[model samples]
Target: MIGLPAAGDGVVHAVFVALGIAAGIAVFAWEVRRRGLHDDRLWIIAGTCLAFGAIGSRVGTWWQQVDPSANDTLAQWWMDGNRSVLAGLVGAWIGVHVGKLITRYSPSTGDLFAPAVALAIGIGRIGCLLTELPGHPTGGDWGIILTPEHAAALGGPAGVGLHPTYLYEALFQIAAFAVLWRMRDRMRRPGELFVAYVAAYALFRFLVEFARANSTRNRNRA
Candidate 1:
């Protein structure tokens, strides 16, 4: 695995996250405007979703690391913790619904958000590709091969090819965005497109986890 020059000090993740949020919001706003559904309350909903999503991602990461044998302190966990994009999505969904209820807005904004979310996720996963562990061993030469030192740094098998899981996910999200964008206007229901996107993503993520080393940790321990 070769380190990205721009990922110095691990700030690439934060930079990409901010960019993702900005790009998502920009696309969402454009979609809302194009669909003639512009409303100030949507911004509020977006803000709420962002806040909750951040919290949920943190909590999800903490949940994954929860172990009685670990001697890490709360401050350490707070300062340096893992996160889950799936959990963030769940949190954002909840936030949007709660925001809708609070604002008494009834129209389904899912169609307006589907493409934006997909695109943002696609872009964000690039950061993951650059900064995070690649994935499980490939046992073949047809994948990202890491040097012994790099493999050790990422806790992967030394001098082996591994699945570029984040790249796979990024490509999937981009493809999903293209598909959803094309079908956005054809969907009869306002939220059906979003539902389809979420379902597809969930299925994809579940399948990809099988190829992820971290996903097998519990089984390995057992």
Candidate 2:
């Protein structure tokens, strides 16, 4: 879900993304209540994360070009730039601290967000699976084969079985969510859970990239 949407898939992608956000918010609220966090300022922090995350997702890829002149204008970037989950995560982390500063709220929020984020990403990736390029050709018996039109739209090979990379990521995230949910209270430190989850995902993503059909990866292979 970190790339451009396929032609006419934008609305569908947005809907799933909205659903993911709703799910994340619901989980966050539930965690807050469960933890007996009475402070209303937590909502402000959550809102800040959402706002900054959205902005970061849109703007993160704008600087891919080294020359400023080669980059899109800010407005153009917002409308057409590639989005990235990692950027959104970084933005959310920054938002947490900014929100804390504004409201003078203290205490780590990572535990509450860890499972919620995992679940949200797991759901959000379904949209990507449906709408984006699946991945490179698998050269094996099993994978999704795109119709000619879908292949053309998504920049994939028609009739070729391709790795469902997004689905792989989605499954990983869902499993991580389950694991994080079970370990939610086991961690003694405040931010350790979040750090561990993010680090694990980063490693997973790096490994998964080799199976992806990204232009950069293709170029590297060449």
Among all candidates shown, the one with the greatest TM-score: 2
Q: Candidate 1, after superposition: displacement of residue 189 in Å?
A: 0.9
Q: After superposition, how far is residue 134 of candidate 2 from its true place, in Å?
A: 0.8
Residue-level lDDT tens digits of model 1 in 1-222: 444333222577677777888888898888878878658888888778888887767664554445745734655545665567877888888888888888888888788778988998888888777666677877787676756555555556656777888889889999999999899899887799999999999899899987875522111100
For residues 88-159, write the lDDT of model 2, one tens digit per residue. 888888888888889998989999999999999888888777677778888985787877777666666777
* Top-lDDT candidate index: 2
Indicate the worst ten consecutive residues by lDDT in candidate 2.
213-222
lDDT of 2 at 27: 91
TM-scores of the candidates in the order shown: 0.86, 0.92
Clashing pairs in 1: 1-146
lDDT of each: 0.74, 0.80
The TM-score, computed over Cα atoms with residue i paired to residue i, of candidate 1 is: 0.86
TM-score of 2: 0.92
